[model samples]
Target: MNRQAQAAVMFLLGAALLHAGATDLYLRYVKAGLQPLLLASGAVLIAAALATAWYERKRTRAAKAASASASASGTGAGHTHPEPRISWLLLLPLLSLILIAPPALGSYSALRAGTALQKPYALGTLPAGDPVPLSVVDYASRAAYGQGRSLHGRSVRVTGFLALDRTGTPYLVRMALNCCAADAQPVKIALAGKLPPVLQPDAWLEVTGTYSPKATHDPVNGGPIPYLSVTSAKPVPTPHDPYDETWNN
Candidate 1:
């Protein structure tokens, strides 16, 4: 492609990066912490593209003037370059980002995962709330490794999408991201009591339950899978940032 097209592509790509960083669209692909880096990268790309375009235009004008003077003197002008056209393909991802943004990963990954997220470093005493709220990752950590000492008496509330095992046993599940979706691990707590009728697959829900000492082995990795005795449950809208960053935390 010509220099002009290269500049245009760079500008579009930088704009896309800036847009993603400036808004929640980026949360679908990366953590909140990377926003600053994205914005910086976008600015650099846009500046470089603009500078390239300006220089190319000035050089083109100078070349034209030189060629005109050469023709007036009856001398030949310099030859132009003929670069490959494959560079035009660089526009595909930019167009995809603009027109058809990809959706975040959901239950399809969680249910088939080889294992859940690793246990947190340390779990403190359950906080003071009638139904104490916790991330699914935190609850799983408390339930499995810490022996539910903090969870025994207090009712707990957590939110995540619904998934079922091969035997149709329901679970409250969330995808735990260490970095991005590519490295996401499932954080699941089995639901052992009555739930909302016809719980749709991958539907987000808020569940209030009591932690049960009884546990099951992970079907894939043979680790402890904690149980939550469902006392109350409700369907909820999907969260803006669907990942549980507690793993990163």
Candidate 2:
């Protein structure tokens, strides 16, 4: 790749980053908190690319003038500096971003990480609301450590991707991000009952269910994972924000 090609790559990358930041796509990979930073970085990168292009153009013009003067003075411009070639490998990531910006992490990642019981929260009482809408993290915490005692008689709606293990055990998994996808952690909620056979792993679903008191709680270290008794499972499109932001802190 010549200087122009290298500059073009930089410009494309910067534009891609900016596009990701400006759209809902960035939320798929990272928290909304980083949007401003991403936008700033993209803008800076584009500006830097523009500046570099300008500098290179100016330098090339100067080199031509110098070479012309030297040639006129009866001396050949000592071999012009060779243009550098950028490796083609640099295009892979940019192509990936352009062609297929991957969706948020799914069952493959969730299964690899497995699921852990949530730590106990000291909230004296569960938050007020009927059919209390809660994050998988919150539901897991209350179910595991609180022994479903707090969630008793409460109808709740939990949304996440459906993941099934080799044993055919189904789980609703949601990833929580602290800063970015790099620090993402999976929170899994086991779902009971026969789900639609057509539903493949990583299929997003909104499960309205109640916590089973039968779920064994390991208070020692919150070891035993919890389960939910699914009342109704409905297919839903991927959420605008796929991650559970409750645990982002």
Candidate 3:
């Protein structure tokens, strides 16, 4: 690409990153911890773009001065090749990010993806609360191994998008991202008891429930799917950050 186009692309990309950070939109694509990095990187890109523009201006002026001092056409600045049209397509994502950022991974991607279960860990004790809030990753992990002893009898609340497999079995699902959406995987919990009549896919839900010892098999993998014996379930607006960030760590 020409220097002008190169600088423009850099500026647009930087602006897009800044826009994501400024609006907390980065949470949709990456882990929460990357917020500062996103902001800083955006600033760096913009600075580089400005510097490139400045240098290009200076070079152009010097070339013009040299040409003015020359009497022959051969002494003038050489012609610059036009940048490839395909290169401009790079701005599509940047413009989308700045103008209409993508929504977080939802039921469509979650249900399509196979379960991503991390090795079980000792969660020890439940936190203090009437309905203790828990991440979907934690609940799913515990339920995956050691019979979920930590979650037994505890009134735990978890949030996730609602989804149903081909069998119409409802699950409370959340995507777990390693770094970004390209590596996103779904952590699903089979929800049981006291379900609403109308459970729409991609609808966000906060469910208060106790862990059930019995589990179901995944339709795709046939692996043990964790169960949550729910006490209450209510639709809630989607959160700023939708990925279950705890699992990757």
Candidate 4:
């Protein structure tokens, strides 16, 4: 590839990265904490692109001046620079990012093996609120390791996509990210009652339910997981930030 083409590609890549980081698009794939790094890298790439252009322009001008002087003296021979083919693969990622704009990890991603639930922090008094909002990761932690004792009488709310186990048992599931989607782990809760007829896999919903600490088998990992006795549920639009990060209070 010629220097110009390489420089252009770099610029495009940087711009795409900057755009993703500056906007909410990045949150879908990784934690929001990466924004600053993304932006800095993008700026560096753009600066490098500009430097490449300037250096190429100066070299071109110098070559032109030398050729003109030699031609005037009728003593110069033609000089040629080899051009190499640029692989089409170079454009694939940029095009994909611009056109498709891939979504974050979802149900299919959650189904992958080797993923496990994230460990929760030390327990504290339940946060204030009736049917308080609780993350799937938090609920799972309190349910299994806490012996379901901490959540015995408290009603909590959780939001996640609808899914079904092999036995067709309905449940709520969410993938929490430790870094990016590559390390995302799925946290699930079995819904204790019938769900609305229209519910489908990947359909986002918020449910208000009580935690049942009764010992139960975890279909995903074959260990104990928390269960929710769902009292009420409703469809909700997919949240802009889909991941539950450890740093959140």
Model 1 agreement with the true structure over 160-242: per-residue lDDT tens digits: 99987778888888887777767878878888886998878899999999988888877877866889888999999989888
Task: Please give the distance, in angstroms, between residue 19's alpha carbon in candidate 2 and its true position after superposition.
Answer: 0.7
List model 2 lDDT by residue over 82-110, tens digit each: 65444878999999887886778998888
By TM-score, the better pick of 2 and 4 is 4
User: Cα deviation in Å at residue 91, candidate 1?
Assistant: 0.9
Best by TM-score: 1
lDDT of all predictions: 0.85, 0.80, 0.84, 0.76
Which is better, 3 or 4, measured by lDDT? 3
Question: What is the per-residue lDDT of model 4 for residues 91-209, given as tens digits with 9 covering 90 to 100?
Answer: 99888876776666666656543236645567667887788888887787788777677787888988988776567767687877777867777777778864686768788999998
**Cα lDDT, model 1, residue 88:** 77
**Candidate 3 deviant stretches above 4 angstroms:** 72-80
Query: Which residue segments of model 4 deviate by more than 4 Å?
Result: 73-78, 247-249
Query: Which candidate model has the greater TM-score, 2 or 3?
Result: 3
lDDT of 1: 0.85
TM-score of model 2 vs. true structure: 0.85
TM-score, candidate 1, is 0.94
Candidate 1 collision pairs: none
lDDT of 3 by residue, 1-249 (tens): 778789989998998888888777888778878889999999999999999999999998998788777746565555767878888788777777777867888888877777887775456577777688888888887877757877766788999999987878899998888888778888899999999999899999999999898787766666667999988999999886888777755
Candidate 1 regions with alpha-carbon error over 4 angstroms: none
Please provide TM-scores, in order, for all candidate models, with all chains considered together: 0.94, 0.85, 0.91, 0.89
Model 2 spans with C-alpha error above 4 angstroms: 81-86, 116-125, 193-199, 216-223
Ranked by lDDT, the better of candidates 2 and 3 is 3
